[model samples]
Target: MPAVTTKFNEDDTLDMEMFEVNIKAQLDAGVSGIILGGTLGKASTLTGEEKQQLIRETVKMVAGAVPVIINIAEQTTKAAIEAARVAKECGARGLMILPPMRYKANDYETVTYVKAIANSTDLPIMIYNNPVDYGIEVTLDMFEEMLECKNIEAVKESTRDISNITRIKARFGDRLKVFTGVDTLGMESILMGADGWVAGLVCAFPAETCTIYELSKVGKMAEALEIYRWFLPILELDINPQLAQNIKMAEVATGIGTEHVRAPRLPLIGAERERVAKIISDGLAKRPNLPAYKGLSMA
Candidate 1:
């Protein structure tokens, strides 16, 4: 699943037309799933109604070709419950839910928060565990609390401690499907037995991302690593706060997206823009002719 971005107009409103176009591009590129309104999707800034429209439109665009996963990023359990209810209504296949947006709750509070939301809807959930970016760590112990809830289905493992991949696989194995959230560690995560990647740069280079994922999954590391080397510079951008800007820029270069971001996030200015442009442009210049990824298998 490519965790996608929201394209905006200069006035900072939803570029609904580009939004549909981008989703079509993703599907045409053969992505197995699409996740709308996550950290990169700028869900934090979107209003409830906009988010609803986006998810519903996504469900319509997808036409059940692939799973449409919505990120529930509300700050409170009640709001999250409402979001989950909305997702169920919109017919989303899965949800990537954060532990409650700000005000890092203790483990018990966090488990309770997730439990309440899980009970509110039937949509399967991928617990987003990016402690560094999100502050609170959804540790293994907290996951134990979550196991009591059946809807908590997978983990977007962005702990950055790649060893956590090993630990999670050891503990849960098939119980919780694992998808590495950070693009930089995607190769390592797959090698270490992660089920798949919930990616960002795939928005710009879906075929390449899917190729690397398939190569690594099939034990084709040498080829995967070659692509990973060229991809490292681009993947690194996904981890920074400016990812929304960085990815939008790459999308412009790749013809699948635009660089117009919302207010709080201005487009990459002067030097920073130039540097990122150099990386992406240089990458495109030497982009490899990879075999298309056909069978959509994460494992």
Candidate 2:
């Protein structure tokens, strides 16, 4: 599952053509699902109508090949409920929801907000428990509280704590699925028995990302680590503040996207651009020839 990037034209309009291109690539790489309108998708910058449009288009394009998940990152409970309603109407198969954005709600408030949205729709929900960037940890205790809501299915664990994966497994077992949202920790998290990855860099390099996951799934760590080590420098871009731009740079280099971010976020420039470009360039220069491992039925 990739928390996919939103493609934009020079005028900052939705580039559905390029967006479809990338989605096709992900589907071809055998990703289990498609995630739209998240942090990488510039959900904060996109209007509600744009997000709904994305959901509808993606659902149509995917045509039930895999679940099309829309990210619900609204600030208010009402808005979140409405978002969920629209997503379901637009054929969204699931929702990747974050805690109340812009406001750090306590555990009780957070659980209430999430439950309200979950109750509004029957669509499955994946909680975005990213305390590192989002500032509110949906602890195991909170997960226990949410167990009653059958729609709240999985978690995109971005706590940056590897032990949290084990703890989640030890606590919930198979009741809740765990997907590491951190790109650099993907292989480790998978090796540690994470169910999947809510990935970022997969926007640019889906083959490598899926290859690593597929390889690791079948006990091929030696092969997986070979690509992972080579992928680390470029994968580190996903952890940066300018992560969207950084990964877009790789996309541009790889001919999958352009560097046309919205107004508040201009394309990366100066030392930052050069530095990121060099990292991507280095990674591309030594890009490993992936073995033809058909573990995940990659196209």
Candidate 3:
């Protein structure tokens, strides 16, 4: 697969029109596939019905141009199963699932969490592992257990621990597709045998990310690093869990999407917006030689 990019949200709100535009733009920019309702899409705030609507609209708009993966995250396994069923019925190409958030589950409970969603649908499942947010890490042994679940075919690795990725690739390279969830690690992860990348910064600079991915794929390390340096500032913002909000702000400043996130997310404003805008502006200014910099005039 090329690389899976997410649909950038405005604030935490779902603007179907803007979401469609973002997806179409990423596809045109050369992403391998699209992952809707993932972290960047603020899946938590969306109701089950809203998520179904998001999936149906995304599928309709994509028109099979690329695979669309819907994220099914809920407080309960039953709710996740229902959401997964709806995702399949709405024409999603696959499903990405995060572990239950409110309560920390032990290894056995975690296995059940993953199994419930995997068994709920025949669509291939990509287990989303973000330890910082979930307070639980699906250990290698847990992953081994998950393999028995027929639909669990991939993993969106977000821990940034290279060793874990190395071990997973060495052990189950044949059975699972490993995709890096961190944007800054895109090149390195791909170089380390990751099947693909699920990127958030791609929302701000899809064309730039496409360039980096292409360069890395072609063994153009020097060139890829040159582009990667320009992305570091924005990537720094993503280190926090508030990446969804930061990405949306960058999108607004860059004319990619609206900056209208929903409640509890507290849309960036005042100093926060100013700081984010300055970072983006400075990053663009520093990379005068980049195509994205030149394209800023067009934007």
Candidate closest to the true structure, highest TM-score = 2
Taking the tens digit of each residue's C-alpha lDDT, what string does model 2 give over 100-185? 99999999999999999998999999999888888999999999988789988899999999999999999999999999999999
The candidate, 2 or 3, that scores higher on lDDT is 2
C-alpha TM-score for every candidate: 0.96, 0.98, 0.90
Residue 175 displacement (Å), model 1: 0.4
Tens digit of per-residue lDDT, candidate 1, span 1-299: 89999978877788888878778888877788999889889989999888888888888888999999999888888889888888878778888889888888988998899889888888889999988898989988889889788888899999999999888888887888899999999999988889989999999988899889888888777888899999999998898889989999999998878889877678888999899999999999989888655673545
Q: In lDDT terms, which candidate is top?
A: 2
lDDT of 2: 0.91
- With a 3 Å backbone cut-off (N, CA, C), the pairs that clash in candidate 1 are none
Rank the candidate models, highest TM-score first: 2, 1, 3
User: CA lDDT of each candidate?
Assistant: 0.88, 0.91, 0.77
RMSD of each: 1.7, 1.9, 4.7
- State, as a TM-score between 0 and 1, how close model 2 is to the true structure: 0.98
Error of 1 at 101 (Å): 1.3
Candidate 3: the clashing residue pairs are 10-260, 10-261, 11-260, 11-261, 12-261, 12-262
